[model samples]
Target: MIQVENLHHRFLEIEYLRIGEGHTAIIGPNGSGKTTFLKLCAGIELPERGTVTISGKEPRAVNTGWVGEVPDNNLVFRTVADEVASALRFGRVRADEIKPAACAVLSEMGISHLSSRATHTLSGGEKVLVACAAALALPPEILILDETDTHLDRKAAENLETMIQRRPAPCVLQCTQDMDTASRADRVIYFEHGHPRYIGTPEETFSHLYNTEMYPSLWRIAGCI
Candidate 1:
């Protein structure tokens, strides 16, 4: 399990508050420190105070994998197949086993046909799928996704939902603007002014946030309210 203790981060006037785990969704308006919080949780950025412990170990200790908000940020290999296979290499899997492992991941993600395609040529949605597949191939103890659903279409989004449902991680933190995604989370966290204003089931959090003026107007515009 992931445990966050008295976490406090600030950049000028912005601050990030403490948070815990269990398939949590972090929802907030832009500039509410959502991405910064994710970066801190993923250990890309250190907390100025407090501690974030994943499985009793720091995030940096586990070779933890992350799927960033921008798909291109995760891209290193030229081909879709190569990108998926990179995770296997990171795990020290043999060269001959890489192809089958990559193929399996691509198939599982419903992108087997695009295995040979260049990563840069794939559409935004396809790249997101590829990045997710890469992150899941090795099955990290914690999976942190930042705004990954924005590029996905309805079908791809459904596929991603299915994939996440089957994830084995005890801690999954997804930062997303999509209510459909948040609605499925075990817990929903609302961040306002860099602090958690609400934390509970999707229905509870959404209902509470909807009635308040602090809720994002886009959620109402999208009919999620």
Candidate 2:
């Protein structure tokens, strides 16, 4: 379980919130605290007032993986294979197992052909996929993504979405403005000005916003009137 109480960061304030294990999509306009909320959950940013905890421990204390808007920021190694293996190596997995492990993940992500390519040479979509693969190498208990779809083409987005659905991570949190992507999640959190305006299933949340221009694109994606 993820819990936040009396959480305050920047211009946002969330008094109490609890999230159970599952895929959750966070949606909001720009600067609505969506990214900040995810970052706090990922332990990327510490809250000033309240506490953010994942499974009873601070987010930083847990085994967590995150991929943000900037894919290149997540890439630390020069090559695809090396980048994917970096996480496992840091976790102290056996050296002999690293190569096969990295290869396996890359293959699973359908990027096996790029394993030998230099990381800097990959396209925007490819870089995002590789970064995601690297995060999965850690096999984290929780995974967080911030607007990663912006970098991906349709096919690449579909591929990554499929992997996210299949991964066994107990908690998957993403911040996105894409209604199509948000609709696929088990739960949706809608934010405005750093506060959650709605929290429910995708259908329920979209239905509530159907009459407002707040989500013009979402209505079409959800087939809502």
Highest lDDT model number: 2
Error of 2 at 155 (Å): 1.0
lDDT score for residue 97 of model 1? 89
Across 40-71, the per-residue lDDT of candidate 1 in tens digits comes to 77899887888877767887886566889887
On TM-score, the leading prediction is: 2
lDDT of 2: 0.87
The C-alpha TM-scores of every prediction are 0.87, 0.94
Minimum summed lDDT over a 10-residue window in model 2 is located at: 213-222
